[model samples]
Target: MELNGVVSAWLLSTVKVKKIKMSKQWGQKAEELEISNKVAGLGLGQKGSNQTSDTEDGPDAANPAEASLLMKIIRQGLVESKLDIEIQRKDPNSPLYSVKTFEALHLKPNLLKGVYAMGFNAPSKIQETALPTLLADPPQNMIAQSQSGTGKTAAFVLAMLSRVDATKNYPQVLCLSPTYELAIQTGEVAAKMAKFCSEIKLKFAVRGEEVPKGTKITDQILIGTPGKMLDWGVKFGMFDLSKIKVFVLDEADVMIDRQGHQEQCIRIHKCLPSTCQMMFFSATYHSAVMEFAEIIVPNPIIIRLLREEESLDNIKQYYVKCKSPEDKYRAICNIYGVITIGQAIIFCHTRKTASWLSEKMSKDGHSVAVLSGELTVDQRIAVLDRFRAGLEKVLITTNVLSRGIDVEQVTLVVNFDMPMDLNKKADCETYLHRIGRTGRFGKAGIAINLIDSPQAMEICLDIEAHFGKKIQLLDIEDAEEIEKIGA
Candidate 1:
């Protein structure tokens, strides 16, 4: 669903990632999704080797496009774009124009080719709604509230690449991610899309990267963290800020919270010429972040998610009543796969717990991976890469990794410890993003919270009350009840 890094389901039919050996269970899940997606009119995309498809088929489809289907999965929380046709819209025509497929965008031939090869058969609901307004000439600024699997990364990457002038041989676009890991993830998606744009050079301005002094920085696209961008663009005179055409802040909520990052981001924004287009994206927008965003991106076309979509109703919420901290280990193993399933993610409150869980799970002969703030940027990327390759069945980490990690096979998310904010209050937003890692696209997913104390139970209850969604008590001892998760 995040297809953020995971390939789209229909396109997965033709994508052959060499090292990843998906199990029969994985194949079955993919097959079901491929079938269901086709029925929804999202057929397969192009495989690199094959250049032609019949008028109605993917280049490598072995079966007919009219194959029988499985149960339909609803893709919810579509984005709605209107600058003000609430009588004051940016373009009276924008709300009326939506593309069913990327082809309708009429992207450059090579750019479109990369899109198809990446397995994006059709634009996600958000993409179809937002791209039209984003790609229009004399670019319009935007502030978007979107969740994982809604195609926010791909949407912005498409916009950045579309506006780049490859022939200029200079940086035309700049994207700011909250952390080093997120910048790399967003870069991975952009690199795949710009594969065919031979002359477009994309650069990462993250930490530890070195550029020679006096060497002209001519990359057409830039993605990095705010501190590094400020250090390189301001402390040093490496970047030519005046020529930037488009500027973006991915995960603006976190950026606003990071100490000094808000000021650094603003500094970078001030250097850009007024004509530069600004875009701010985040899953949840707190009032502070909203205020910060408006200050940097003026008169933006704001996109809001419907209440139903924001509710995370697609993920079933359950809480286990555990007697002690030791019992959480048992609870995790018990409901991991009530039925044959894909990968899973487990969240803990601290790195000490994450390390302990990792050692325990590994000693018990389970294939698990651990990620925390302690990991270096490269270490975190490698951990996510292994998880995506299906080398690890479970990823145990803390809030540090919660906001990003968009693996498609993830079907289960466990709160090894309930999440809480700095003031010890239930963190409804963090809980949503944690479980949001699963249920990508439109697939059903399950989230289990292990409450080991009255405090934890109270925290769980607060979250339930905040979202107006019930968190049912789960009986781990009941087999039949557990098995119904996949149902």
Candidate 2:
């Protein structure tokens, strides 16, 4: 409510000053509420699950240097993406927070090295925030929403690792995935990250791998499909359900929506000790599933990144600031280790850049393939066939493969150049479709862009304005930060 000079004078004479001040405060509060509502109504979810400083995996807590580094990263505002994270903790006075790096989490020394060894120096937006809650001393259950391929596997894996006692290991951590492939994939990530921890062991409880009667299974972490876990933990009585410390239900949305998984999960949940840390991680959760989760896992820390549009929530997107084409190639080389976990699709603005990158990636000892509009239909088919068969981990191309391509294994997508239209404006549709190549079939995925020039920055800003999502900077020079590329 605006008052002109004459109206203000009249109000001062007619109304009490205290009443006028109260009215002004009410008007300001109303405007603030309207803005807050618009933001709250944004969509949700990000690439990876979150983490923070909770339980130390080993005796070595973070020193002053590490703590300083943590504060520095937070102060620097590093790794800023359009990931709007809202953390709801039961203790509002003692709120949980987001950490920028694993170093800040004060993890065990070996475990910290293992995180970096797994090519994860810093946590993704989700992992940084979600970890502390997962690792808190009294232990809190967490219901988290993150995109596929966002390092959620690693986040939960680290949580399980932090809570385990290798000396008394007998299946302390149990993770239930929805499928054999997902179980294997998660087991792979866990095994890789836990390698430096020495005493830690991970086993997949999928088909044809069951233990015979009277034999004990000693693996510290057990990952499996719901039915296998239910049978192994309940029917067979293989794992001492009471001894389990962490129970993770990955792809939980799918688990609940499936025909029989809900019952199996519930049966298994009933067997777990009250002290166990329960975690539910999924890309999307309907209100019904969320309600059910609330019933099963009480007092959970909820972290959500509001969604902007369709399928965008599935892709973890970032941009690298490069000075030249060579620098862009260097950025690719830096993240090559992380991107190779699954098949990758690197989109160039033109066929020349694609060909050049294909050559460089191959020369750098990567199994690379090329696809372009110049290729014959048969050639394109052959390239895709090789990529699908895992013969080529990296598929460099122009925009030809942007649409009608659904490779479940493609977890990484690289935009070596910004996308633009014929008028040289940002090509919002093509840009969306290009990154959409990854994060397909409800799987997690990562997308990176290289902005080398002022024009490229302009294109990125235009794309940013189009979607109302920020394209945060990625520094290839920082080895620690580089681990976050495909996370």
Candidate 3:
């Protein structure tokens, strides 16, 4: 859901503060001070702000350096506390919201078992609100806007599974994704959820999958990309659309925004039975996409779970100041030296840039993987497998890896080239998605924006303003500070 302009304006006015100070010479002692302040900020006042050092004099009173550090710590604490409080205050509670157990949702016994086996204790906010509406007797169409990693997939997957008649396996459900990788991933999730339901057959119609000529698709569930789904449905006549009961458009915003995808999706939708339940899910909802969705999904129960400021609250965003393009490269290397990053993704603006950076970083003794549109499907899959298995430490790529791919161990993201649209203006939504690659499943993550020019810096500021949050500055020259910041 889009943020209300008035609410975002109010949040910016109140919570926007100067960037936090980073001490260049911060050692073990300074680290302790920062931790104490952070604890105090979180309401654990174990040590008072004015406590004295072991020298029988207050640290701030005896040493000017320590004093400056104390003041900065206090300022940082106040800023963080106020931001948290304001976000909590501005979040409006929905009347449809309720806390319920998976059993209470009345899911199929096998699906419920799968849910427990997957370790889901209860329904997420989206699932809580969407499941009942989606699984209602008179099947309803739904257009849901939720943040990444918010269990939107499970919600719809459950709906699809519940609607499918497993006894007769003849393609009762169809799901479409923007990319082949995403389609495969969604298919895997659905398969896992239907583990106990062995009768439910699934088929993927993405690239590289060959369906024999004149072969009827007997799979009860089909998940694939729009282009391939359309090809099989219209050209090959492989699937029976009249019997399909559920149709889902995962990552609906991306599909609608791309050139041919929207048309192909519409064609596939037209072929479906009029009684089919259509469900659309996306992290973003552009005005044009929403208008198109409205036309396609009749009387959809709209569920929006995103607020402007709280979208990126779990991510700690910072920008490294670089003097030149060469300096940006040096900064990248220096970052790896300072922090123990699990798995990081660096975003470049172009495929050329991604390839260049990957090669350079490899030369600099860093194992990096590159993914872009230029890579073939097999190459992309191989790279992703290596990265997911913890074999690769860094991935340098363009916008291809930006949306809908979840890597839990990815704790760091670097925007080597800030996202910009055709007009060269900061594409705020793209930036959000790029950073969102990390910080999955409510984990704390860091996103670093590498700014080497005035234009890049301006773009960073624009993103900051757009999110109503200040981007902290990182000095790459200071190893100690960089370690603390990365930590």
> How far off is model 3, as Cα RMSD?
21.6
User: Candidate 2, residues 225-342: lDDT per residue as tens digits?
Assistant: 7887877776666779999999999877656655566667766777788989999987666666677677678888887767536677777778889988899988887887444567
Quick one: RMSD of model 2? 22.5
Tens digits of per-residue lDDT for model 1, 79-103? 3332121112465565545699898
Evaluated at residue 259, the lDDT of candidate 2 is: 54
Ranking by TM-score: 1, 3, 2
| Candidate 2 ranges beyond 4 A from true positions | 1-81, 310-487
The TM-score, computed over Cα atoms with residue i paired to residue i, of candidate 2 is 0.51
The most accurate candidate by TM-score is 1
TM-score of each candidate structure, all chains considered together:
0.63, 0.51, 0.61
**Could you tell me the lDDT of residue 127 within candidate 3?**
74
lDDT tens string, model 3, 1-487?
0110111111111122234445633453364454334433433212122222333111211121122222222222111111111111122452343347888777878888987776677787677778887888778788987645567778899899899887785889999987766776677778788888787778887776766666778888889888878777766677777888999998776565445676677667767888999999876666666667776788777876444446487899999988866888999888888888899999887666766788888998888888765555457667877887888989987655655466789999999888876466787877987898887777888899999888898899999998888899988899998888765
